[model samples]
Target: MKIIIILGIFLTSIANAGEHQIPTAPQKYLDMQNPIVKMDEQLLKITSRLYKRKCSKCHGKKGDGKGYHAENIEIKPAAFSIPDYMLNRKDGQLFWIMMNGSDDTEMVSVGPGTDIGLSEQQMWELITYLRKEFTK
Candidate 1:
């Protein structure tokens, strides 16, 4: 009886191990071509500074959407790391949001000469930086 129980346990363990095997990474997917160009140091600096000055208030320091003032806002800030949320928003939509702001939330327009000021170029750069950094 003891040997039978031990053998059963051993077989179950082996079966479970085989069933729960980790999936291997696909080399073909990893080797797929992408057209994104790397940003220069100056561009990176501008992105970092812009994020610090304007975005850090609500989007957080690392763009994790947990800024200092986030708690006080009625709606929680969007998490950049979320692929579903990021995928739904297009570059044009994001640009419009940056320029015109959302009426539903605390987000406000940061267009040229506005209180939360940002030029069109700056907003576009910000959009580029965010898309590159967050999207998979």
Candidate 2:
């Protein structure tokens, strides 16, 4: 009986975990794709560093959305490793979200004039890193 109860709890937690969903981006960005065809190995390394610097705080080091600041934030961060949901999203959509940030949510625009802004190229790099490292 004890083992049964523990198993049920574990299954419940797993079910609840995958329920967190990132809202969809606007239509314009929904069809966007990563335009960088010549992704270099060095750029991939730099992209990892960028995610650690800019995204890991709330998205977690593994992109699991359970980072240190996750508990305190109103909107939960996205778990990039979620295959089913993330795979359905276009790379361009991710780029736009990273660029403009989600409104009424903790996701802030990491482009320019913001606390975590990145250059356009850098944004693309970050997106590339995210897709490569996570979302398998």
Candidate 3:
């Protein structure tokens, strides 16, 4: 009986994983806008390299969330390439996630003081790259 109950709970968690992993952005972040107005080729090149180094391990090269590490991770990375996925999320939401990663998953804070330490401008640039390259 206990085993069955545990299995039920575990299965329920897996079924609802998506709902659990996405952290809510504070109103401040939610209200914020992307400062980057345009993405030049030079900026794209820089952010692409940054993405490859920091994000591709889990989010995948094509932003499909099927990177080599994705299989072993308990919670899957966000699939940015999914149709309208990037469109629905606010710029602030995306920025907040990168700045303060979800606590329930492997995504970590990549902004300011984190070990991966990305500047605000760099993070915004990455968001620009995501919108341009991954949005379907």
Candidate 4:
């Protein structure tokens, strides 16, 4: 039984090794930053709940990408806890991703124009929360 558990853990790591790559966002998005300041506690709360509502189902509550539906999906949710990954990705890039889902994966867009999607400001708020809370 111990061997089975150990094997399972090893296989899981192997399964995720080089599973996917973060695509390059356009130059326009790469240079952008969150316009809102980090000290905005009120807005952060709102965005936190929004993250829970829209993203936590896949990205996990703590931004670890181990949510309830994580195992059942093909595209792995990004592990935002990794500062290296999150730090390099600009706010605009992340915001654009939230607005327009990944082209090569199952990251469906959650921004405006969709029937049930986030508005521009709401998307920005989400990014703010991610940067302030998770990426630190």
| Candidate that would win on lDDT | 3
Q: Model 2 off-target regions past 4 Å? A: 1-21
Every candidate's CA RMSD: 14.7, 7.1, 1.7, 6.3
Model 1: worst 10 consecutive residues (lDDT sum): 21-30
lDDT of 4 by residue, 1-136 (tens): 9999999999987787557676667888878777766546777778888889888988899998888889888778988887676777788788777767887676888878885478887877777787777884
lDDT of 1 by residue, 1-136 (tens): 9999999999998786455421222454334332324577799788878888888778887677888999898666666767566676666666666766666577788889889788777777787787767664
Q: Which stretches of candidate 4 lie over 4 Å from their true place?
A: 1-19
Cα lDDT over the full model 3:
0.91
Worst 10 residues of 2 by lDDT: 16-25
Best by TM-score: 3
Error of 2 at 40 (Å): 2.3
Model 2 over residues 1-136: C-alpha lDDT tens digits? Answer: 9999999999987786566456677887877666675568888887888888878989998988888999998668988887775677787788878887877788889887778768888887777677777775
Give the alpha carbon lDDT tens digit for every residue of 1-136 in model 3: 9999999999988788746658779889889989997988888898999999999989999999999999998889999999999998888998999988888689999999999999999998999899899999
- For candidate 2, give the lDDT of residue 98: 83
Clash count list over all predictions: 0, 3, 0, 0
Better by TM-score, candidate 4 or 1:
4
lDDT of 2 at 39: 69
Candidate 3's TM-score: 0.90
- The TM-score values for the models, in the order shown, are 0.66, 0.76, 0.90, 0.79
Candidate 1 C-alpha error for residue 107, in Å: 0.2
Which residue pairs collide in model 2, if any?
32-92, 110-117, 111-117
Which ranges of candidate 1 are over 4 A from the true structure?
1-38
True-vs-predicted CA distance for residue 62, candidate 3, Å: 0.5
